[model samples]
Target: MSFITINNIWQEYGDHVVLERLNLQIKEGEFCSMVGASGCGKSTFLRLLLGQEKPSRGTITLDGKRLVAEPDSHRGVVFQRYSVFPHLSVLDNVAIGLELPQSPLLGRLFGAKKRAAREQAAEMLKKVGLGHALDKYPAQLSGGMQQRLAIAQAFIMQPRVLLLDEPFGALDPGIRKEMHAL
Candidate 1:
């Protein structure tokens, strides 16, 4: 059996049909990519995988179980638009997702635990070429920097599946290639 399966999938909005009778199966450790023109259902399919959208008809299963309505920690996403926390610094923004799921209290980690989370967030930001902006808020960063910050935030969570929707759209080719390397 495949690790991820999409069976007889169809997505529609009112009178418009985006995807029709699509069937796909991906086994464990396999890599998959979808390519198509604009307005195609690639984004829709990704959204379905991310649990951001439900198929009009059919099922999408992961590891032999069906997907739930709400998105889970098992899946991570970096959207095309900016998804940073304007109120928080870059370090806090990146560490927040990782901190929340593991923390027993109301997303608060103190002392060494807090320090470790911040250190990890800083390292992730450095890897994504946003090290210098650690103290800055999301508003201070440029579009590409903001996108990189978002990527760092999502990647730090170490989710089972990472879904990126035009994640590098705002980055220059050189920086995009660098991100691909990381």
Candidate 2:
């Protein structure tokens, strides 16, 4: 079976049909790019794959299992707008997703797990070329840097599928090209 499958998918928003009988198959570890004119439902398709929206007509399957629930650990997303939390340091923002909820008292009293998560987050940030910005907040970084940080956050969890919605849309052309290369 295909790693990710969309069969006869349809989506409508009010009177508008954003996707009509759209079908797709994406293989695991394959890099695929979607290109089209505006209002072509590219972003909507991403939302559907991410389980943020339901198909009006068809089924989406991941590894042969019907996708009806949002599998938090299986998917990661990076949006065009900076999705990082403004108040947290870059390392914290990246680590937040990797941390699990412990018993409230234990979580409050323990710093070891938090430190481990931070260390992993720092490693991920370095992998995405943001190692130097670990201590900075979102507002302190440039647009390109912020986008890179977002990429790090999404990839830190090592999800099976990474959804990127026009990630380079807001960057200058040069930087956008650079990000595309990365």
Candidate 3:
């Protein structure tokens, strides 16, 4: 079986059909790209894969498991809009997934395992070429840096699948190409 499968999928918004009978199979560790005109359901497809939305018809499965809800840990998503926490430093933003409270009281008093999470976040930031911006807030970075930070954040979890929705669309052509190369 395919690692990721979208079988006979259909999606609608009221009377408008966004996707109709779409079928795709993606193998594990494959790099795939989908290009089409604007408003052609690309974002919808990503959302479906992320389990942020459900198709009106048909099935989506990952490694033989049916997707019926917002998937946990197994998927990561990056969007054109910056999803980083504005108040957090780059390190904190990238480590948010790994810092879920062990206990509400412990998190409140001890700050959620900062050392290890920060180390992992730093490593991911370096991988994405944002190592120098670790101390900076999202507001302090340029658009390209912010996007790279977002990429680092999504990838730090080492999710089984990554979904990107126009992740480089906001950048200039030059920077967009650079980000694509990373």
The top-ranked prediction according to lDDT is 1
Q: Can you write out model 1's per-residue Cα lDDT over 8-114, one digit (the tens) per residue?
A: 99999999999999999999767777888988998899899999899999999999999988898888899877599899999999988778877968887878988
Q: Candidate 1: which stretches are off by over 4 Å?
A: none
- Any runs in candidate 3 off by more than 4 Å, and if so which? 101-112, 170-182
Ranking by lDDT: 1, 3, 2
TM-score of each candidate?
0.93, 0.87, 0.88
lDDT for position 105 in model 1: 80
lDDT of 2 at 152: 83
Better of 2 and 3 by lDDT: 3
Report clashes for each candidate as comma-separated counts: 0, 0, 0
Please provide, for model 2 over 26-133, each residue's C-alpha lDDT reduced to its tens digit, 9 standing for 90 to 100.
Answer: 888788889999889898888888888888889999889888556467888997675888999999888877774433434322479777888889998887678898
Task: Decide which is better by TM-score, 1 or 3.
Answer: 1
Model 1 worst lDDT run, 10 consecutive residues: 27-36
What is the RMSD of candidate 2? 2.6
Candidate lDDT (C-alpha), each? 0.90, 0.82, 0.83
How big is the RMSD of model 3?
2.5
Candidate 3, residue 34: how far the Cα is off, in Å: 1.3
Candidate 3: residue pairs that collide: none
Candidate 1 local Cα displacement, residue 9, angstroms: 0.6
